[model samples]
Target: MQNSSAFKKRIKRRISGRPHVFFAVCPPGLSGICAKEVARVSQKAEEIFSDKYNISNINVLPGGIEFTTRLKTACLANILMGSATRILMRLATFKADGFRRLEEQIKAIDWELYLPSQTLPDIRVTTHKSRLYHSTAIADRIKPILHDRLFLKEPPRHYDVTGSAAPPPQTLMVRGENDRFELSLDMSGTPLYKRGIKKKIVKAPLRETLAFAILTRLDLSENDIIADPMCGSGTFSLEGAMMQCALPPGTFRSFAFEAWPGFEEKSITHARNRLMAAARTDMGVQPLPHILARDLDQTAIDHLKQTCTRHRVFQRICPVCDDFFNMTPPPIKNNQGVVVLNPPYGIRLDENNDITSLYKEIGHKLAADFKGWRTGIVCPGKKEFHALNLGLSTMPFFHGGLDLYTAIGVIGR
Candidate 1:
């Protein structure tokens, strides 16, 4: 009984040192992109918690950013971030060049902080331009460290070779460059981009990150009215609604952090309560500022409706099946809002149509019919961009591995 008590105290200390970290992993060649994303998100959070908390230590990493906080900021990043893939806690970072060095560094830490008894941990490793290029070998090397240290003759009975179980001890993430390794733990089981609720996908569907990019370009506000003219799958509209309502992106899904040792239900509850309390309802006379999504394809419209319903934003949005050129904007409740479109870019052989003509029609309708409204158009190529003839300045953005341009036009009254 004395031995048991001492072991429990040791476990408590280990868990206390393991802080919750939110890592924003960015695509390659876009290194440091996640840092900017983290800063933007952190700024928004500081505004929200201005009275209660003071945000400290915003730092950038190779493919992400790290900040120290006692609150459940991962929940905030999960919901609000558009550019991040996963939000993880940084267990530790140290230099290790080879298998032996990796083992020593990993074994030196107190694994009990992350791993609880009766659970086996899943581990994943990634290497780039390093001596430890074989990730499988690295995983093999670390297995014994865990087995020997934990007093198991074989591996833990709960250990799973398949990735189905929550990784006990912790999920090791080894990133290598130039024969040097940096190891961190993954607190997010799947990429934060999954957002849990979007189970179905459409052809050439925009990722949630790209959708958030479009929203950022628009400079969204809680009270502003927004529309997606070619809102396929309703990604843009749904992300927009969550932003306006101050909903954390992670609210819709489960996180890997929940499985970590010392995870408290009260911490999750406190974070969620703060989010709910911050949620503001629209009480204005007009219907919660129109979030209209229109598409020419009936199939696309059906998919959009299903997605909106699944996300519980169906009632908040107006979906219409009609050609964009023929459709009219819903009567402006206050004549203050913006129209954003993500039209098909002639990328794939099938989508590659005479897009120049399509842009010409879009320009004509915007200039002739929708005066006093601001417009944003996202397209794949420069040739299609010139065809719009909207006389608006253009900004370059990326979506789905393609370089795209957005032309923003302010229609004169």
Candidate 2:
């Protein structure tokens, strides 16, 4: 616990120059939630370290937020924010109307600052409404320049993205629009949604980032209980329980930034340790709210039990193999709670599935047994969404290539 103060001073002293530009990427239409999470996490960092993390200049774009912050804060944001899919460090942006101009722009960046000589850069490019429209052609043009400039002396080698045979390749993202391009380094090698703890999954499991975003819309309090009646693999319950327990999303994973130049491993390790220590201390004094994770499929319940037990959060999440329609709301202290459901879309599990009956059953159960409780359901179609018969407002979003809406309402008002 005492080590955090020293770590705090080191971070405060190191943020001297102009802040770096970073973009927190998320699913389209949820950038607003991701931006809010960034602010909330930075505020918590300030309260803990007694210093500003300098996470400012938040510009919300169509798919993500661009913020200016020091490298350490960017690293911390990767560990803390759950809604962001990944964070990218913007290196440079310039006009690239022709291959020569593209080469010039690429040559201007100091590759050594971000990439080591031995690693093959994994570059991904996308272009729109530009003279240089072919993505592969753009990447092919940039690769040779990078190779000749960075690996002039080293023996040539091939490194796959998996890094199983060699070290992980640093990912470069190039996006071109109207003859101008933005180049960024992917600070997160793998998507942030794969937190490594959600090993147990069923058909069409919800992404953790999406789950976190839905929970953020709930406005949940510490005293509010969470119930996932159709909890296939327990995504909603586990995410909510983890939040209530103060577990950072990146707890069990490594990031691409750890392999970058001048990473400050010792300070980052200290900060992560401090965050874990604080979570433990907070959990010791605070009573955890109950998370009811129920599934009709016994196999799903069994898998969820294993995951919860492996992570030592079994006590907070009560898993049962029972049909959701047969269950009633569990007791709550304040009569305040929410029920979250991600029902089958009738396309994956079974072609003959009757989704309307399912939604109607869900709505009837909630109205009869869960009065005054808030609800969130992933409705795949208007027919199914209206079957609920609950006066819920819908927020449209996309997931799994399907246009969907998150229907939210209070039951039995």
Candidate 3:
């Protein structure tokens, strides 16, 4: 339909195109929820790829989402998604009941398109229900072919497989199941939840990724004032403030895609611009007047301030040091809001070893101080939390442990 020059121009528009994308997740139970998040993000932009993409599966067994997207789209996902653990670039999938068949499939793909000749790739192989199930043997079978494809004289020895150093920034993961094999490359060198802004640390700080997951489940509104009375290192509070900005979880982190052979400059710049455009730029008008955090430990409040400052979110969060029993709710522009509590319990912290009384005291405070506020609390079990006498609903959350899930209800409703 077009001339040769026009065709060249069309090809120029697609950047770092790839065949497929896979977003690694956690806890087989959360696969459906992760699928919703993946779809929500993918609809924003699909032009980076040369053609339309399709979602293949929401894998419950391996805990990931498999979708067709370009390499550029993978880069965008690494910067934008919150629920995913890692973004994997799929190479090829084929029936491989034996090592010979596996090697043949690996040899067919164009490895040169993804890896520079001089770099090293960390290889990880896993097997389930396949005849060629020896992980070490699978690695041995595929490694030589990759080395040959890159024309490396000798494979680099003693390099850490998961290292993010300069020489080798790529990781290849191969999974064999049911007499078939699927290969993928890791586009996110470091996990996405490590936002790189936590300058201060606490003993049992909630994982940032998990924090975002809990926030998403709460369905928070920008207008809802938020408070975390037992905020350790300000994880929940900072997460709430960032949501007001619509900021991507990996906004400040480096990605493994930055080092790929197919890396493109304008593509990443465009992706960053796309994310920034999605960002809430209303600086003068914040979502809520109060997203407050308080802790009995002065060290935690100090750490919260430090972490928030390093994240450039100091103005948006309020940190206080006072015992939950003695402290009153922070005043907000609105009369109603949400109160979050991730109190220490069950060998994590709970230093005094008195979860029963602590739980009772928290219940008393909720009735006395927070009459109309919605509450989200992380607790070990519903029976223990129900002792507080709040009529809250809960779902099983796999992180921290199988015992921990978030409880949601309204205090004195």
Ranking by TM-score: 2, 3, 1
| Candidate 3 clash pair list | none
Runs in model 2 with CA error above 4 Å?
A: 1-17, 45-51, 149-169, 280-286
Residue 234 displacement (Å), model 2: 1.2
Greater-TM-score candidate between 2 and 3? 2
The TM-scores of all predictions, comma-separated, are 0.80, 0.88, 0.83
> Sort by lDDT, best first: what order?
2, 3, 1
| Higher-scoring candidate on lDDT, 2 or 3 | 2
Kindly list the per-residue Cα lDDT of model 3 for residues 1-413, writing each as its tens digit.
12245533443443354345565654534566667767755665454333454344545446777776656556677776777777787777789887778888888987756665655578998889989988998998888888877755534222222233553267898888898888888888777777767788787687777777777777767777788889988888877777767877777667777755566556667766666676764556434456778888898888888777655544578888987787777554433577888888755654767676667777878888887787888877765587676767775666655557677777776
**Lowest-lDDT window of 10 residues in candidate 2?**
156-165
Give the TM-score comparing model 2 with the true structure, all chains together: 0.88
Q: What tens digits encode model 2's per-residue C-alpha lDDT throughout 1-413?
A: 11246533543454323478999999876888888988876786675556776678888987899998777778788889898889999889898779998998898876645555556579999888999999999999889878866674544333222223434347999999999899998887789987767657888888888788788788766678899998998889878877776778887677777765435566567678777776632334666667888988898988888887656654688999988888878765555788999987745557676889988987888888888888889988888889999888886677888888888877876
C-alpha lDDT score of every prediction, in listed order: 0.64, 0.78, 0.70
> Which residue pairs clash within candidate 1?
21-89, 78-250, 79-248, 79-249, 79-250, 120-168, 121-167, 121-168, 122-167
Q: Tens digit of lDDT per residue, candidate 1, span 1-413?
A: 21266755765555543334546665433334456666656665666545333335767776566766433445455555666776666666667777778888888877655554434456677888877788888888877776555453333323222233454234667677777766666666677666655546557766666566556666677666777888777777777787777666666666556654445546455556666667754544654576888887787787667766655443587778877787777555444667777777644325556678888888788777676677778767787788878777776756677788877667554
User: Native-vs-model 2 lDDT?
Assistant: 0.78
TM-score, predicted candidate 1 vs. hidden true structure: 0.80
Q: How far is candidate 1 from the true structure (C-alpha RMSD, Å)?
A: 5.0
